[model samples]
Target: MKILLLTPQFPYPPHQGTTLRNFNLIKGLARRHRLRLFSLLAPGDAPAGTPVTDLVEHLVTAEQPRRSMARRLRDLVSTPLPDMALRLWDPRNFDTLLEHCRAHPPDVLQIEAIEMAPYLFGLLAAGVRPPRIVYDAHNAETLLQRRAFLADVRRPRRWVGAVYSAIQTLKLRRYERRLLRSVDAAAAVSEADAAELRSMAPDLPLAIVPNGVDLSAYDPRHPYPNPYGRSGPNLVFTGKMDFRPNVDAALWFADRVLPLLHASNLGPHFWIVGKSPHPRLRRLRNRPDITITGAVPDIQPYLAHADLFVAPLLAGGGTRLKILEAMAMQKPVVSTRLGADGFPVQDGVQLALADTPARFAARCLELLQHPERAAELARRGHAFVTAHYGWEKIIPGLETLYSSNDTLTGASDRR
Candidate 1:
């Protein structure tokens, strides 16, 4: 099969969630298919050469114009499309796709998310007779936006953000309802997202292509020393710090939850790891217990050595890939029920689940006090992912969808 893949970002360095999925999927599909990647690069992003050169037949990158609040506001006021959709749709990207197709038309066109849908919209408007199109949904953007808006109710000061999220959600949901109906097929990162898409377009062919981890890359056997040499119990949360959900998670963990731990006579050090620390996250700098590592070359040392991996994500969608990677490393994870959404795991069997700051704090203390129980949970999580969520196992079903012409009756999962 000749596959043309479009993504919202360059999938190299595979550190963040969506990029991690894209990089691995591209790598897996390339070996069997004639694959080409058309990815977006931000103004300052270093177009790292050939991370996929070993896998892909051709690679083209479209530079997304730098973000401007003014431009976004103008688009919101002027256009009917969602601001995010408008922000990502660059006609030049379609021109690049068009140039390639004119020479060698692809067998399949797989779009990464609703963010990339406008490019396809643009192509269809141009009267292009493209091949079968697949919408690879990272998350139900409409649901994610609604969740984000509701989360702001807790932070009354962020009312503006709450309002903005409401507007975005309304626009995006309407746009997605119309757009998804046009696609030949769709693949979601989790069941939660698939459910939303199915409700919008019942006849749209959907597949649950869950997120996965590279087991060899996250081997538990690799000896990693505690980079943060503190006597207190250390908790780690890793993601792109500049991202809104991650920034919110780090702040909520530190401001609301860490105090609960401190009041109970337990000393805890929270390590917020990953690149591009948002300026707001810098505020956590004053709190001695928190250490925000802006960008780290590697996270294995932290994951291997931390007393616990905590994901207190209140808002966002899709199953967390970081959680799977930590599980592969044989680390105990404590996440909000929302944090562990869409993945199959028993609460106590695989990892601890907690929601409130007080409840979340108690669970952290329990893990710190009962090392044996934490280790048992870690063992189970590792075994579960090893058996189910490895990249090789997850990608084959997705490949089948790309190759088969048979009509899919409804959304399907490999398991």
Candidate 2:
């Protein structure tokens, strides 16, 4: 099959869950099918490689609009809809896609996120030969914003954020409705998400195509000691720190959970690892125990060395790949219900589930104190991920989806 894979981020250097899953699928799919990728990125950023160009037929790159107050206000005032306005500046990317389609249309067009859906709207509007527009929903992104709004945000700004979320959700839902009616099929990272989408658009063709981790790269055989390891117990939270969900999670953990454990003086050190540390997260460095490593070449060694992997994330949608990778490396994990939101694992079996600050702290302390129990949790986690969530087993479902509707043509004619 000839596939046109569109994504907001380069899937390589797969440190985060979305990147890892998308990267692995693309790498695997590329091996079997002819792929031409039209991927997006944040401004001034590029995926480090010739692998994309060398392996895939072609790679189209564009910068996402900068999210600033000026841009936001301009977007709100300029367009009738705030959500479309925010993503409207990327006309160049759409033009790029149209040009690619004109020259080499694909057999299937798999868009990786809701933000990229708008680009397809105009193309479809112009009566471009309907391609199999598969929305590879990495997360129910609007739901995450809705949850953030439900939380204690500031007074005046809270309403603004809420309005923004409502607008975004409506736009995405409208696009989803139309795509469901016109496109071949759609997929979500979990059954819970698939069910929600189906309920909203019952006639929509959807399936539970989950996120998978490449066990080969994230191996336990080559474990590295905690780079942030000091003389105490190291608790690591890895994700894109600049992301609102991750930022909120780290702050909540540093403010609520870490303080509870500070009393024991068992040297509770928190390492916030990933790319693009936000200003809010950077402030966390003020504390003696919290260290933020902006971006590392690799996370496996850190995962191998950490006493326990902690995910106190309270906001965000979709299954967490960091938690899965940690488990794949045979490390003990302590997460909030929100952190372990979509996974099929049980408490005290594959992972420890703790929501409140006190409970989360106690769980971590218990793991740190009991080596045998912690080791057992680690072993169970590894077994659980290997049995169900490995990429080799999970990606065939996606291939099936792409192949199911052969009538759905892509931007290329190779298929």
Candidate 3:
């Protein structure tokens, strides 16, 4: 099959969550199908070392729009479309993509997430005949926005967030319903998301093709005793630091959770590792106990040398890929229940779970103090991922989803 895969970002380097999902799925799909990857990459941000181009027959990319906060907010209220989806809207980009498709249409089009769905839909809106459409739902966007307000730590922003979330929630819900009504098939990253998509379009050809990582590259033993750098009993949290949920997690954990560890004289050091640290989160560099590594060429050493991998995520959708990477590295993970979404492992058996600051902090402390127990949990966690979460195993399911010719089972999607 000749497949055209649309993604919001270039999937190379596979350093972050969205890229990880896209890169793995695309790589796997390319094995069985001739593929053209049309991704929206921000200018000057292309990654090296990963041979992503080698996997596809053709690769196309568009410069992502960079909007200031003032303009972004203006568009948010002015447009019925949620900015989350609209951010990927580029009329010229669509023109180029549409021209290529018109000249040579593929067997199918797989729009990776909500971000890129608009591109295909836009072409259709312009009366272009689209190929068999597969809308890959990554998150229940409305639910994600709702949680952004509900899980926020700052009281002053909560009310304002609630109002904005309420508005965007309505917009995104409508957008999803209308968009799904037009797709031939759909797939989601997690069962949680798939269930939600089913509610919106009960008969859409939807499947669960989750985010995955390269198990071959991430070895617990290989990165153990990392030569990168070392400090006190280290606790590491990894993600795009500028992301709202991550920023909230860092502040909430620092202001509430990490202080508890410090008060106990545990002398535990917290390492927040990721690129593009938000200004708010960067302020924590003032503290001696916290080491904020803005961005590193590699993250394995930070995960490897850590005594405990912590995820104090208060709000987000989809499975946490960082948690998966940590567990794959055979590191004992301590996370919020939401943080550990889409995984089958038991909390105590695989890792620890805590929702509140007290519980979250306590878990970290316990894991740090008990080396033998932590090591055992890490062992089980690694085994679980090896058996279930490896890209080689999971990618086949996604490949099948791409190749599936199942007729839509429900009522006709609006033409």
Query: Highest TM-score, which number?
Result: 1
Select the stronger candidate by TM-score from 1 and 2: 1
lDDT of 1 at 355: 96
The sequence of per-residue lDDT tens digits that candidate 3 reaches over residues 1-415 is: 8888888888877778888888887777777789898888866557444578888888877888777889879978788988787787878899889887887688888888788877877878777655577777778787788677676434775677677777888888888888889888777767777777888889777766666668877887683456336555888899998887899888888889998898778788888999899998867999988888887777888888888999988888877889889988889999998888767668899989999999898888888788898999999988877777777666555544544575332111210
Would you estimate the TM-scores of all the predictions?
Answer: 0.95, 0.90, 0.93
Candidate 2 to native Cα RMSD, angstroms: 4.5
Please give the range of 10 consecutive residues that has the lowest summed lDDT in model 2: 406-415
What local distance difference test score does each model get?
0.84, 0.76, 0.79
Candidate 1 TM-score, true structure as reference: 0.95
Q: Which residue pairs does candidate 2 place in steric collision?
A: 105-411, 105-412, 106-410, 106-411, 106-412, 107-409, 107-410, 108-410, 224-301
lDDT of 2 by residue, 134-240 (tens): 77777765465556566534436457656666566665565555555656677777666666667666765666667777788778988466576366588898998
Q: Give the per-residue lDDT digits (tens) of candidate 1, residues 38-71.
A: 8888655565565686688888788875658888
Model 3 regions more than 4 Å off: 47-50, 223-228, 403-415
Ranking by TM-score: 1, 3, 2
* Candidate 1 lDDT score at position 79: 76
**Local error of candidate 3 at 282, Å?**
2.6
Better of 1 and 3 by lDDT: 1
* Total clashing pairs for each candidate: 0, 9, 0
lDDT of 3 at 21: 83
